[model samples]
Target: MPPATLSRTEQSYLLDGLRSKPAERADRRDLHEYRMMQVDTDLSLQADGSARVVLGSTEVHCGVKAEIESYDAPHVNVSTDLEFAPWLPPSPRVQVMVEYSPALLHEHNATELAMITDTVQDMLQACYALTGNSIGPLDARQFIVVPYARYWVLHLDVYVMSWSGGNVLDAVFAAAFCAMYQARIPGTKILALDKAAARQDDEVDQDDPAGIKFITRGRKPSSSAALDDAVDFALENEWDHGRLLAGREDVPVCISIYPFEDTYLLDPTLEEETALSSSIAVLASARGHIYGIRQRGSGELTLDAIHKAADVGASYAKQLAQTLQARFV
Candidate 1:
């Protein structure tokens, strides 16, 4: 469908309907109802994990890629993105990218597109802070190629193929969430090398195929991290497909609400979004824990409105998770 180019007459028609005492949606959905979303996984043969989500006419594709890296690299300036967490000294981290097709330039300027992608990335990073998988000896070791020396840098790329409606961030996050759920990291094994078998390059990785074993040890690995140098690990039977990860339930569901003063809209269309006073996107779990909050539009939001929207979003997230849980199984 072409961009929702509404004339003054069409705009008034929509605003009038929405501004009424009992707001009416053109699609006939309840005031706070979301359209059904269709999700498909394993779409990319090259990606370790991949999923596509369709919410109404908006479509997003998420692919997960990870590379084992050593701790010797420079530290990421995460202070801007996440609060100081001692456990995060040097562990698995995620890189989320929100890329929109160039065709979307017809509807949004370059600055607008960049801002949207940045906001989505921030929202996801906040959510990751809340759900950064359990990394301990007893827990499932995620992204630990070798204890203390190397870890995985998980890359989550979300492509907005098309945006016909509101909820672009919602759809993007949903696709990323599903893709991470489906993602599997390849297993790693330690091969003790004799001094003779090891290469002569002592400055760094000496003939390290995985680049996990460093010639010299630096900072000690965080105890709360995935693995310790002393901890021994090996999979019973590992394959190219990799192993399914745990803590899928830790992933939060993203829900955005468009607020028109006292009225709110869920899953608004492009035209509907245009008439909104403001919008709030919240990342929350089915258990009602709010992870992050982002506000858009120039209009101010009341504290009461923010509270109500968060509550509504959290409630809806539970239902959405329940609806999709079966497919994950």
Candidate 2:
């Protein structure tokens, strides 16, 4: 069967509503308003952690799974970007001075993997509030390099089975936070390493790394967190750089927004998403600093709107941070 296509008028109607402001109504309702309820959830026996996020009627389930592998190569530095880039010739001196940026794969699966990797990294940073402003490449110290053999590595997998729009990023972020809070990374003590040895002759014992010290207790994989109150604590202390993250707080709060047409929405639904042509995502810190901004679609944006959107997002985000911190910290 042939696929159905929208007539020009139908497309224009959607475009207009999404891009232009609607006729002013007697009652002034802002462009974006959303309400979400956490409905049902379950544990992932096969995954490190997982959860189901329900935004009103829409539902999305996210799972986190991880494995440790021997570090290979210098430690692959993963970078994230919103749009696809077309290659261009480098300047004469630029090529000589800087490392060539590698070309991204043209395959669908590869592209998807790239996106997944980026999302997982973001999820980790958001959940843990890790230090160092570095992006793209993993730091050398984070990986133990083995030239010809395996090195220790951590891999995180996230699955999005269902989605309804209110902010998949928010849902995914919340889910990932839950999952990581419940995740188990077996604590390890460094074993002695002989200076002059290869894997074949290495004396480092794999069976037990130094000694397995019981620092963080292990828990049976359950559907929910044992420390539910921690979420409240996180909300209280907040994710301020020195204040909350330095062993003082629990969860850091963030606000993100999607821009459509000319009107901006605070939180968008699936119907609104389907009607829009493009979106720009902005994330702000509690201190009113712009952490990240990304334009996800082909939609155009004006500097004025961009400035206004950041202000809007930051305003909402600060409130969220304070609320969460009040509950937790």
lDDT of 1 by residue, 244-263 (tens): 66566657777888877666
| TM per candidate | 0.76, 0.49
- Every candidate's lDDT: 0.66, 0.39
Q: Give the per-residue lDDT digits (tens) of candidate 2, residues 153-186.
A: 3333444443433355555544443443344333
What's the residue-level lDDT of 85 in candidate 1?
18
How much is 231 displaced in model 2, in angstroms?
Answer: 38
Name the regions of candidate 2 deviating beyond 4 angstroms.
Answer: 1-30, 37-42, 72-152, 164-169, 196-263, 284-291, 318-329
